[model samples]
Target: MPLRYQAIGEALRHTIAARPDADALVVPHQGVRWSWRSLGERVDRVAVGLLALGLEPGDRVGMWGPNSAEWVLVQLACARAGFILVTINPAYRRDELVHALELTGVRALVLADRFKSSDYVAMLLDAVPRFGGADQGSDGPCSELRFAIGLGRTVGDIIPFERLLEEPDSAPFAHLETISREVGPDDAACIQFTSGTTGAPKGATLSHFGLLNNGALTGSVMRMRPEDRVCIPVPLFHCFGMVVGVLGCVAHGSTMVLPSESFDPAAVMASVERERCTVLYGVPTMFIAELALPDFGRFDISSLRTGAMGGAPCPEDVMRRVCVDMEMREVTIAFGMTETSPVSFQTRTDADLETRTATIGTAHPWVEARIADETGRPVSRGKIGELQIRGYGVMLGYWNDPQRTAETIINGWLRTGDLAAMDDQGRCRIVGRSKDMIIRGGENIYPVELENFLRTHPAIVDVAVFGVPDARLGEEVCAWIKTSGPLSAEHILAHCAGRLAHYKIPSHVRFVDGFPMTASGKMYKPGMRKAEERDPTPRIPVARGSERAIKERLSR
Candidate 1:
């Protein structure tokens, strides 16, 4: 049956009614644990406080902080109070923060004092110069912004998070239930900023029904039980962590364990062992780091049974190791964009290794997917094309940008810019991005395919394939490799010699310590491509040495 929760507030109320005493949230690092009933009360208090702050329904509330109890409270409080939560990435610097605040017209911002090197207070003050001197509930240069709330230490003229929970006698606390009842399932719940690799980020507006159901379905696919505990290491600002990680646990009445404010391999391992977490969530790169930890074998991860991996292409080898080494036999791979409530395809828990690793599984329930050519017409099964999705999970549109929204969504189908192919069984395999595709001398080369092939090399730890300018071919393949030890371009070319097509072989290979990554853990290719273009180094020809010598060297 389709999900019937009218709003996230209603969903939380139902969960509390069903299992009030059950453990709901656990933040080990913060030493915070709350049952469903306690969590509901806290959410109500925060919602009431938000209302007291003069924010109206449909107002934008920006949250800038790492994963913590306060972050989760703000997320639910906004939903309950009929406000749109704009999730600001914790890694955003001054310029990016200003853009997000101004673009979304965020009325109130709730942020931390500092996370790592980012001082949220300093950045806000710099973005809006008058912020430091602005009176309580007064508008600043941003115009729409009315106030600021600090999660840690209270900055000058900025309210603290604890103050939000302290209800004033004059405040309309009783109206919390009424306001929550008025909020509808179709109302905008969240405006997530897309990780802008090409240009400026756009806020993807998602509805309460879309996010709630997406989380529920994701949890169901992972076979989440009421007794299960889920450890989330991904950032809460991203959909992978908030929607699939937090909401998934809430939907199943499972315990949510926050390993830390940010990604920490040791913290994750320790949380799983101490909390006895049955489910874990992360991108493939996170799993790679955890598996590579020097003390990885010391951790007792026997409690881990199922989890979800998304946010980037999951290497086959990583998937296999996660199953065997991490003991996540039921680990699934989810694939989608931020516009589609982040998950439209996920592997089933009972799926075989080939299905789990080779494909991104079938279309989610109540969701329709098709592989379409450039003309928007459906292509034949197994043919490569852009993947389009139509479902309740699709976002309402980009916030206040109808022009871009119309360009992206046509006749209710959201055009995911990703290039993919669908099998007869409806399983989808992402074949690089349409924009990321490299066309060299009329040959279309999918970087993901080449990257996957290069990953099989024993010396390569990670590789990113992209197109570099070529005078004759118009464009040639370039591979940026992160290797384990000393490796030359000759060794890499020799490995790709017979396995891949001549045109697909990387024309240029450069060794790098690490690839630039987005906050969401995806390889930031546009910057790398631009840097390579600016340098325009001379290409080294492939070494044509004795086949016998190459084979003998490869054996060692």
Candidate 2:
């Protein structure tokens, strides 16, 4: 496939011109339905509104919300206006939010007032002391944050989201068009923070050229078409949603159907039925939840022909069920990280079930992949080693951290930190992560980050966090702690309640006298992993669904 060296805004404009009357975006729960032309007009208004707020071309604008039409609008508007869109995870709590804002020096933040149990406005106010008050700002972090554009509901000093849509007295479209032309293909467009081996998350700076082409290629692999309606249940904060789900649709002029603000199994099936969606995107656990619904057979998801699944490893049984029961025979598995525009390898729809389930397919066009030994020499095919990639998809670098960037992306190759093996055919199977990162239900949770947070408790002397095999989530977080004071599992859970995201909190906790150590005196993580694997206890109670009933019957 030929690459398109266009900025994200350029691609959006092309699609709108070609398919102005076509359905562009739909959010069923929010009662949003828009055509390509309408979406384009709203995006432009938002862009000019952002400029009206004194935000320059290179300023950072943080998007802190779930999957909503407004979220999508902000994303494209930032790209069009040349503002770096910093995607802040909706699951993030106060500290994480502050870290992201401080790290990116976000000038404006677009946030939803509340989602489910998360009161985003309250959290933002708590995190940034200078947010709503008449103070110049604090001496601490997030001093640069000047605007909090509220979505859903307006409160206190938050600038209402609807206010941005109100037409200005001046000719705003011409002003926006002038600013849009200045955004180059190589300009930094997004800052997506991904947790590393270190405790803190690093912002991976991606360019318009890299993200546009990668999303285009991903859509190509899925055989996406202009008429295809895609059901996207993934979080928009991650690349899986913004890069692949949104941009991929833009590449083909396909309709983006957001099932709900957040992932809801029933909502997903409902949207697929109502819209006759041709494509669906999600992680393994999401598919599991959808299939587990008691009334799964009621939804006419026959409209689904193909989709993309990634983030965590795909289970063979689940893949088989998806092909047969769900009738998604053409569903493909994708592999990549935030640093590589989030997709370097994706299985083709034409491939057999085993090929799709067992391996991440050949490298994307223009992407170079190799399994390298410790000496940085390419290993023979079928040998397990470090998977490395060099490609147009690779990020410019981790934002503002040159030393760590040098350590990660050496000589143009982005160290994936994933242990993988390749066959002679160039198909790759991910063995494991060299850096112990836990992916719980599509959310990446770094062990060091959790361990560091747990250690902050005065009662805890040492803590170790790792991923244990989970039947549903692919992997769930497990932690072992050595405490200086009397501490129960309840106490540890309480400590992590508000401090960390729900998924990052450990599902299983064990109190240990001491940790098993290697000869070199490092913690022996493999030993702990093996012991946990032998334990017969279910990690967590399965929710009330067909899946739970089946598991209970099998256990009996």
Candidate 3:
């Protein structure tokens, strides 16, 4: 099928017209369920209310919250109103919050009062001193932020979210149809802040054209139908939820089931059982957690037929279990960054277990993908190189940062920075990130390859492999592992003794209950390495007995 070049609002209206009474959204925790027609009506009411706040087309609107019915409303409303929706990570604190607001020039913000340990209202007050000040619209740290809508409770000039739905704004509400007509497919629909290991985060601008089609294509790969109920446990702030999970359902006219406010394993399983959801979506770590639940089999998750796993490298062991044990035989593995509307390639539902677990499938429909050498030249199949993509799914650019945009998107191709190799069949296997590759004693070592090998051990639940500084070899392998129980570094080393190359074996091993994670749930390698740098003895001898033999092999 060719890509759909329609605007999100246009596509949404089409679906509502076709499936007027079909279940569109269900938030069991909030006791809310809406049909397509009802969702469309509420979405329009919110859009009109936003315009009533004196915001115009192209203005930025930020959403800072977890997965709530309100979050979904604001997400679709922004598209309907022609405002750029900037998704703020629920994990962001004062500094990160302010940075995203100021960087995107967000004119209005809709947020939950509090979730988990973070007090969003207090954080906003601290980040923007003028938030509730006398001159609310006056110049200050967050100069462009003029309005605030609180999802739960309001304080100090912040308006309660209910007011938006109840706002008796007849004029804007009446003109909603006309307003939506003015919005085009190429208009900026969202700005997602991409987490960078270095410098500050960049706001990746995405268009309705890209997001709408990416979702449709993703849904098609999973063979979604109008009756499919998709259980989404991922955070709505990320593309994984908003685009892949939400938009995918809308594009396919499928029902969406919000499992919980945030990711809770029990809530997800319960929602699956209660809603009888046929599809599921989550990151690999999330699947691992759900499968590890003590009473995991108590829930009838057999309703699950298919799903997509992305946002981190999926372990082969876990993938196999999801198929056989979890009954998700048609599950797929997705790959891409935020800049590519989050998915450039995805495994097909009909793919065999090995094809699904070993590769990220072929390029998305109407998208061009290639593996390129360091010089930006295309590399032959079966050779590792940087993966680049050119398609409708590519992001417009980084918001207000042309210099960095120029550096990232060259000659219309967005450089993914991830190293990968394509097979003759076009299936691509991810090698680690180009920057994550370890160079030890003139040899190149991919951390993901090592991590995958370590995960094969029954005792090892999860692992993160990265390089640490070494005076002689330039860098050395270090592994941090989360296991099912107490396991020694010696035992881990003995397992890798013959399976892995000598230099690839972790020179230092530390067992931990958890690995540092970014707001988006990716392993924060830089943070782990920073903490390692603080340790006085960065290099520890590998497994006492095998130390001499391994040292001799590495020295040679």
Best by TM-score: 3
Candidate 1: residue pairs that collide = none
Model 3 bad stretches (over 4 Å) = 134-139, 167-170, 536-540, 543-548, 551-556
RMSD (CA, Å), each prediction: 3.0, 11.7, 2.4
Angstrom error of the Cα, residue 139, model 1: value is: 9.8
- Where model 2 places Cα greater than 4 Å from the true spot, the runs are 134-138, 437-556
Q: Against the unseen true structure, what C-alpha lDDT does each candidate score?
A: 0.87, 0.85, 0.89
lDDT tens string, model 3, 321-394? 99988999999888888999989999998887777767889998889999999899999999999999999989
| Candidate with the greatest lDDT versus the true structure | 3
TM-score, ranked from best to worst: 3, 1, 2
Ranking by lDDT: 3, 1, 2
Minimal lDDT window, size 10, model 1: 538-547
TM-score of each: 0.95, 0.80, 0.96
What is candidate 1's lDDT per residue for 488-530, written digit by digit as tens? 8878877886677667888788788888888878889997898
Q: What TM-score, to 2 decimals, does candidate 3 have?
A: 0.96
